[model samples]
Target: METSHDDDSLVNFADDQDDDLDIAPNPDRFRDAVLYGTDWTVRTLLQQIEQGNIDLSPNFQRRDAWSSRNKARFIESVALQLPIPQIVLAERKEQRGTYIVLDGKQRLLTLAQFAGGFSNDHSLWSESAKVGPLRLSGLKVLPDLNGKTYQDVVDRAELGQFRTQFDNHTIRSALIRNWPDEDYLYEVFIRLNTGSARLSPQELRQAMKPGPFTEFLSVRSGDSSVLQKILGLTAPDFRMRDVDLLLRLIAFQTRLPRYKGNLKPFLDDTQRHLNASWSDEQNNVVALVDRIEDGLEFLIKCFGSPREVGRRWDDKRFDGPINRAVLDVQIASAFDPNVRRAVASGALDLRAAYIDLSESDLDFGQAISVTTKSITAIRCRYQSWQRALEKAVGASIQMPVLPNA
Candidate 1:
């Protein structure tokens, strides 16, 4: 189900909305969602870090993705007194004054490292531990400053001038506080990070809003048997597209005709709701997972391989990306009580009958021709498949009422 703002404006799941998360909906809450102050100097930020006020955990960032060279460049940029973007932070209730880094993690970490705080093992500490000394090399602007570590600058007044400049440099930080809704923070993180990093929707969800349902998806996505049967072993899931496909299946199983054409938002809403209801909705989750597992096993039994099932159209070859259009419908039909009875009674040869119908059905081609993103097309294809399957199995199954029908 999609949620709206206080004014009933459509809120995009992947984007930030200026809405507060009070059940009573107050305009003042919206205005007070985030709290910011005047720009802070680099020195003050370092002091905050030293005082154990800023949390620099790898909650959202790719750990250690930045190279030493990259860190050097950033430190050099700071020393040169170049302007940088404001760091976004979120205040945690666990610590009254302590804040968590939402954006600008790398920049903040680099500064902390330059001040002799980041341990070589990839953690920033409040104490100025000397486990790993900050060093800068390969300087284009100042060749003399090359190969100088933070210790070298502290010892030399001339080099210390640059260090002083860097310390005094102002880095703005915007703190988000008094926002009771974690969902809004997730949306904001997605919007801010997606522009610079090419994080897939699933990846962004995994990083920004990890929950019980997300953990469930991650575990199921790695099930070798299910994936080998559905997506071929070599199916490159670099972007976590397989997880997305599973999410699609789950979305359809749960939300059905309630789904509109907004694919991303629908998936987002489904996941959010699932995560929210994870404990209370355990039975639904179990039933849905069991049904899908049964459907996949049944499909594999009939087709030999999940990859063999697709929208055949006029071609003798299976085509497209596993054709979810075909999968969703076939699974729904296979689970039909009448169809199951026919199969159990040896009246339905699912494979042979399905192949025959695909070869002869003109309407099936038209149904699959509609864009997969269209809800109408998805429903049409499912209905067409159900009709074909009913004829093949000699089962008279009733169609359920769909949303917006």
Candidate 2:
């Protein structure tokens, strides 16, 4: 990392570190050294901003998240030749010769807007509307300047002085297109922005260089209203952490036969595989989703029924085994060939099966509890059910009848 901490340029805006004040002349520290003279021009910077090439990572705050007054003040300060803080840029490997914004995002954006002529009506700027050409002639001098005011300075210019002044007042220093290495840039981004609201790793992942899977999830999270509805019903106050868990579970379910503890590396591997597979991976995802949905449906059908018992059976009623049996049904549905076939055939009536089982006075909960005896009983029952289903399906025969038969 190439860090520039020139004490001479450091501006101590206030003595109180505890005060809620933004530090001035925040030095541009680069962890990675970059080849100089490889920098971009003002026009190029504006073009990148317009093209959305300049991605603001979690380390960078949102555009216009700063107040309009602060933005206007910043613009005014720049127009009057006042010092603005240096911008921090991290070289990203994924972007390939491009940089990610760390600090000074707001100031850089404000300058870009001015250069692009996007500061017409202050309200338009307030709304972050990128319109109108910047009227360089309208730029005023600092009101608190000790020297001549802006109008006085500009008015007293000779015939060709205006063009010369405009030409000389360059605004190209704000762009940081050169960085030596990614680590240096990342360290600077972390340390310099320590006191500020820090970005979580997930957020950083999204901002810096998100892979296709992350982008896909973001798009799906917004596009699939049905999924959101289902999620809200299941977990209303769902957080990003919970979303990560869901991702892990989905990965585990989809990539059966292989299980790993670490989700990050697993997700990374999955993304690489997905990228390599491209269209085929998408097909697999669709298939996996369908299977999971079918499994859930089977669970609901086999367990969602109320039962009443007479005086003799009432005292011996069991709910624990019943619930465990329901869960077991769900687990079995995931791996059962018969269940897969039933779903594929679309001929099995799960509701009827559920109703019939509900009337059978079975102590399902006790049959699948944590105890060894319960587990043994549950396993035996599962094996019996598997064998009976296999026989019913005529697994050894050349042909088998559908479930309705």
Whose TM-score is greatest here? Answer: 1
Candidate of highest lDDT: 1
Expressed as tens digits, the lDDT of each residue in 1-405 for candidate 1 is: 011112212112111121112134446655758677558888889778666577554321222335577778778888888987888877876567787666675677677777744444544442235335567787798666778877788788878788788888888788888876655565556566555533335644554345788767766665535654565544224334456667777887768767766566677788888889999976777687777778777777777666665434347766534555566677776567787777778787777766776777766655554445566766666677677777776657654444453
After best superposition, candidate 2 residue 102: deviation in angstroms? Answer: 3.2
TM-score for all predictions?
0.52, 0.38
Model 1 misplaced stretches (Cα beyond 4 Å): 1-200, 234-236, 310-314, 344-346, 398-401
Clashes of 2: 20
Model 2 scores a C-alpha lDDT of 0.40
Model 2: per-residue Cα lDDT at residue 231? 28
Q: What global local distance difference test value does model 1 have?
A: 0.63
Off by over 4 Å in 2: 1-44, 47-70, 92-97, 106-189, 207-214, 222-278, 283-405
Model 1 weakest 10-residue run by lDDT: 1-10
RMSD of each: 10.1, 16.7
Model 2 TM-score, all chains together: 0.38
